[model samples]
Target: ISYVFIVENTGNVTLTNIQVQDVLPGLMLTGGPIAQLLPGEIDSTTFTATYIITQEDLDTGSVTNSASVSSEAPRGDLNDPSDDIVDTSDDPNDSSNEDPNGDGDPDDPTVTLVNSIYDLEVSKEVDELEPVVGDEVTFTIEVANIGNVTATDIVISEQIPSGYVYVNHIATNGNISYSDITGEWTITQLDPDQVEILQVTVEVLGFGDYLNIAYVQSSVGGNDVNIGNDEDSAEVDPICLTIYNEFSPDGDGVNETFVIDCLERFPDNKLEVYNRWGNMVYSTRGYLNDWSGTTNGRAVVKDSDNLPAGTYYYVLDLGDGSDPRVGWLYINRKN
Candidate 1:
């Protein structure tokens, strides 16, 4: 079967019952009409034609084909119309198409980076830059993914940036891990534009200024474009770091107390408690590590007089809010 494709009437003289040949395969010309023909006649007429073909007539697997036609008793027509038997193939028209995304052949598909969790970014308090000398402090860092494409296997890492020492454990997204020169914290992934949360902390030991820097990177092959970028869901938040220290009442049981008065008195502004057992009986949350006098849920008060002469574990929320400091302290019985 075939439909009208093109028509051309060039002769100056009009002829009745003209015929066309060399038509497409499986198609036949039933009839057509040409109004009139003049010296400059360029009129064209088209008609729908149809035909049939059997499996036996197929050119095997060659896929090539053609057809022809003839007419008599016609003035403007040829005896045999064989030119219509041009090259005809059974293949679809649109074969080789341009693949934009670099796949192959014509296809329908696309990909994108989605929901990514970046590395930990951080900021510091205007007052304190890093940990205090010989004192523990709280350091806070907020991670973000500032990349063009979403990244997988996002790994976050940090070093004490020198001048500062690790006083306690570091935390990221609320997860605590042992801090050292060789610690690699990782998050799921960060889309081109994603953000993550994390914190790095250290205590001030030696007297010097330290510059703290945290990094976020994609896990897949290094995409120079996505490295160290902050594209987290939320905006990159600022961090406030603090530094300080505190020594419990010198091995004394007399003034041994879980009070904030003594802890906030030192240059190393960290909270602490002196348990004769050299354990921090109490601590605070950075500038507010106020202990409620309970280990998770148990009371440490003995006879309501004072803490007994014994060692106890404690957590110190020291530093510049970049990291919460923790550890042990000693409490002695003051004679």
Candidate 2:
């Protein structure tokens, strides 16, 4: 970076042999020169410096540079005191120590340099894309440092969706803690080119669609440049098992078979068909969506020896430890 210093002679008499000096830590001065000044005359000098930022600079977040100017009386000037008498006393308040020329350099002034540039991103995922009630879903949160510099005291926050319940289980490569009162998670720090993954398990309480959001923050202060990617969201959709109430099995190829959407997802399942008299007329193990309203060697075909049209009941056992579903269904024959 480059800096400029201005030295002005506001005195009535002429001033001469003006000099300027720069004192800046963590920086090297390349070039700077000052010229003599006369009454009502002003001179300006520019200086260039270079510095490489370090961890201490990053911690402190600022660097300062100071510059000062001093001058001696011009030659052959009778009113101005000789240059030899200027260093008379060390006391600043003493007249002898003061610059006899009114155009003497002012007090030292400094400029501060501040550092503010870093990037952080967050992303989330779930083990099961489609979940159901009573099922446990694992959520994974990924935090990455995509900035040019390292970030310290990194923290992440998450709120469990209402429909999901926390299983009190978590996994991560970094040190983390959870607060139940605030319902959030916090982590320590993250370095450049580093990624931290946090995994948590939750049980699905209700069905439908749910959204979970997670956010990331760093203690590096204003150095975080991109706040847009600080937070990420993931959604979960549950597929519920449903059974039809009525269907026609009259060989018309439309609604002729008993169908259930989620029954196929479970391999070990069983279905039993019972008439209104409470007698099971048809039973099958591992129901594979192949119930054509046929029972007791009878088919619902026109003028064929088949079961009569009537109201029936069905008992479906998914064998997945869930409650068995018992509901009434109707079989209509149109021949």
Candidate 3:
């Protein structure tokens, strides 16, 4: 393989440029632009040269590669003193150059991309902890990776709040975590285009509020790569865990349920649900709950009128009293 290399100075005052002919068999030369330079300044120039490379020349036995060339040249022409090479065989009187060092004709090198360029991405932000509270609200977290190489062993973790309690055990495929204790979560390995999910449950404690910093990191050895849980937090936030729930019939039906105005208890107090026997059945942080007049998933015994045509024993935790206020509820089903 044999080819000529060329360079052209197209920058201000003739910036540098190189003459390159890729000898890589699989590569196609893509043209580039020649920028403008100052007037009277040396214009960029490139040489047309030939080169070749063989598979046996590679140490790794890979044909993918790239080559570059740089040289100092004067203004113009082979005779220009600025040119590093003072020898010019283009002269008609030059007999030594006649046959062109020229006779055998074959020696070249090739250039190409290193190997492959890959882009990986994971959601940057997401609801880290979902299915919060007994059944109040859920969280969603997201992340993404975009780069030339594939990523592995990406893990996401979060700390449990002080007062709030852990609902479920952290589930992960393959990863190392701080501990197997409740509250902490992590994801092990995530290949290109692969995504891992973490689910956590929290019980809102007290009344004030709760926000904790969580992080997701890549298994990159060195330091941090983008959102790799480095700084105080490239991505950090305070989550206001206000427990809330509802039971307004989650389907296409107008009569299935009543628009239970729950979530209104945040300012009120813990709800104290009781059976006709005066036995407390359920309690909640917010009023966003709905009693189907049923024990668990089963229906509670009620008279046909549902009005109970009578009163049912119950207790209301009105925050005011350390003890619950007991009373009977009048069933008024709005048809």
Candidate 4:
């Protein structure tokens, strides 16, 4: 980086032996000392200095330096060397400590901020993409520091959509807390190339589509450059087991078979049908919803015979450690 300093003789008296000096080290100055500067005369000759930026400056995020100009007032006492006073004043352009009145106090300090990269990427995933009602789904949220500098005081915000209740959360390198449908994760710092993972578990309360979103809410030490990858979301669709009460298998093409909604979601399941006499007439493991009023159990019922139209009882075991669902099923053969 290069810096230019312009000194003007704003005083009434003529200034002599004008010299400019910068506080930063290793900055080469290539301007000569002005022999004399008249009153109200802006110096035509400019003082220029060049300095190379270092990695340390980028790490700190900014560089601040100031230049000072000093000259001999003479005070009409050129013959008397002791009476000639030297006046030094800092640059007036520095806002931190400007010296507009040419005061001898130390003041000027120009700040230059280094454009440090601050990028954070967030991604989310769920263990069960399609979950069943009352099932607990685990969501994984990962945050990575893809910038060149370390991010400090990072806070991540998480939102759990409706139809789900917060169970618990675990973070690898942060403090995770939640209230109702919102969650927060706090971290002291995350260095470049470092990553953190947080796992949040929620139980599906009702049957519906639920979307969970996570993003980097705030962070200090640097500004985030890329906002596109700062947030991520995962969706889970829960299915509820539904059983149809009646079906007509008369080859009318409507309600032709006993329909069980979401029954295929449970691979390990059993279905049993019983007549009014407490005799099991049909039973099968992994029922495929193909039972069309045919007798599949006892030899007395005749395997190929279609039972008369009547109301029967059914017991379905989902094999998921839950109690079996019992309900009444009606079969109609009337045209």
Give the per-residue lDDT of model 3 (tens digit) for 233-267: 11223233332222223234432321222233335
lDDT string for model 4 (1-335, tens) is 87777777777888887778776877788886878889888774567888876656765787787776767666555555455444344546665665555654546667777777889999999999877666899999999998877787888898777767889888785353444444677777788788988888999764334878889999876677889999999988776676887999999888988877667667788999999888888888988789999888776477879977999999999888899999999999985
By descending TM-score, how would the candidates be arranged? 2, 4, 3, 1
| Most lDDT-accurate candidate | 4
Report, for every candidate in turn, its global Cα lDDT versus the true structure: 0.41, 0.67, 0.39, 0.78
Shift of residue 209 alpha carbon in model 3, Å: 5.0
Candidate 1: global Cα-lDDT? 0.41
Better model by TM-score, 2 or 3? 2
On the 0 to 100 scale, the lDDT of residue 86 in model 1 is 22
Off by over 4 Å in 1: 1-127, 130-132, 169-181, 207-209, 226-335
Candidate 4 Cα outliers beyond 4 Å, as residue runs:
7-19, 24-47, 50-64, 71-121, 131-137, 144-152, 160-168, 174-182, 190-195, 201-209, 218-229, 238-335
What does candidate 1's lDDT look like per residue over 203-300, in tens digits? 55443335555554336523344333432211111223332223244444333334432233334555555454454444444444333233322244
Model 2, runs deviating above 4 Å: 4-23, 31-47, 53-62, 68-115, 145-155, 168-175, 190-194, 206-209, 216-220, 223-227, 242-277, 280-335
What ranking emerges by lDDT with the best candidate at the front? 4, 2, 1, 3
Clashes of each: 70, 0, 53, 0
lDDT of 4 at 223: 70
User: RMSD per prediction, one decimal?
Assistant: 17.4, 12.9, 15.7, 11.9
Which digits, one per residue and each the tens of the lDDT, describe model 2 over residues 143-172?
A: 887764667666677778776777865646
Instruction: Give residue 314's error in model 1 in angstroms.
Output: 36
